[model samples]
Target: MYSGRVRPGGAPGVHELARLVVMKGVVGPLATNVYVLRDRFSGDELLIDAGAAPDRVLALAGDGPLRYLVTTHRHPDHWGALAAVAAAAPDAVTVAHEADAPAIPVPTALAVSGDGDRLTFGDVSVELIHLAGHTPGGLAVLYDDPTGPPHLWTGDSLFPGGVGKTHSAADFTSLLDDVEAKLFDRLPDETWVYPGHGDDTTLGAERPHLAAWRARGW
Candidate 1:
């Protein structure tokens, strides 16, 4: 039975999920986290945020049947390895929201996904939350699987110590408001946040920092 649920402490019971590998990207001179979630039971896998260092990502991927390369936004740092990934996993479909589709350099098998979209492979499913403050088409993948910690892949939107920057006035204001309401205000105290950069943190740990960041007018 599907037993995924958002739990306290950001930790979910993930024993049945097979395995998850956190691949650190090398390009952009920034630490980009690429998640490779596999259905240990069936050997099928899905890649989330194929950023930097194609060779590292491929080596970590290790010749598995990749189901798809899902991007979090159109940013180069987040999708830098798209062409390489697509070339290596020729059959894998690349999914992204319509808003960021054109900006993505490579030819994408583009599937339109927005808020509440559910992506699943082998029994693992993640609820897509549209967090637009970081970028016009930015998205945070929220997973409430029964087997692991409840995770919010905040792609440059929300972070451990701060929020994403907006290049325009409209983008910035709207993003700040969105983060306050859609993200910070909605998640449970224990939600584990995996942002586009830096180390991971929990909702409880970040809530106070959110207040501090808001005060900075960032």
Candidate 2:
């Protein structure tokens, strides 16, 4: 269960996953979450959402080869440290959704569109699920761990309560629709959620409240 999982409020920690060593840290005024996933066998690491505090983020990555730097959306808070991280780890391939790529300051070397687009770093397979609404190109990163339950990294698109805040009802509808069809409907209850900010939650924990979330219209 997630009871043992790190809530990540102000403290930095590491998640010893089956195939990867996930170094999770907090950064910036917004206190966004940054993850350094190192492939257990290959030692290749992938940094997710270099939110802010480049030095701290780089420190979490350590002196080594960072393979990929991926931004989950176009939100400034999510990519505030993107450029800095990219420059520091020039060898790391940068990735983001094609729709949000242009808005990101640094040029994304790999632009992925959500139709079965996947990235591999050692044995870990990263799946990109486009979930709009929080932003025009919000994404939910899924890692189907072969050894255990699937792990999901939902930027701002998802949290324990409902979908991320949308500017309009239409945007909310779009986000909810994509989240249901692409996320809740397909993923199992055991899927672990790593949100952009705040504590982590599983699909099972949030599934029953879907209707309530929809009714709230947020």
For each candidate, give its TM-score against the true structure. 0.83, 0.94
lDDT, candidate 1, 1-218, per-residue tens: 32223222222223233344333333345656676666666566677788877876676566678887888888888898879988999988888877787889977685565677777766567777776766778877777746555767787887767788777767767777787787778878777777777666778887877656766774
List candidate 1 segments past 4 Å from native: 1-28
How do the residues 42-123 of candidate 2 rate in per-residue lDDT, one tens digit apiece?
Answer: 8888888999989889998996579889899988889999898999888899999999999998899999876577878876
Worst 10 residues of 2 by lDDT: 1-10
List candidate 2 segments past 4 Å from native: 1-10
For TM-score, the strongest prediction is 2
lDDT (0 to 1) per candidate: 0.70, 0.86
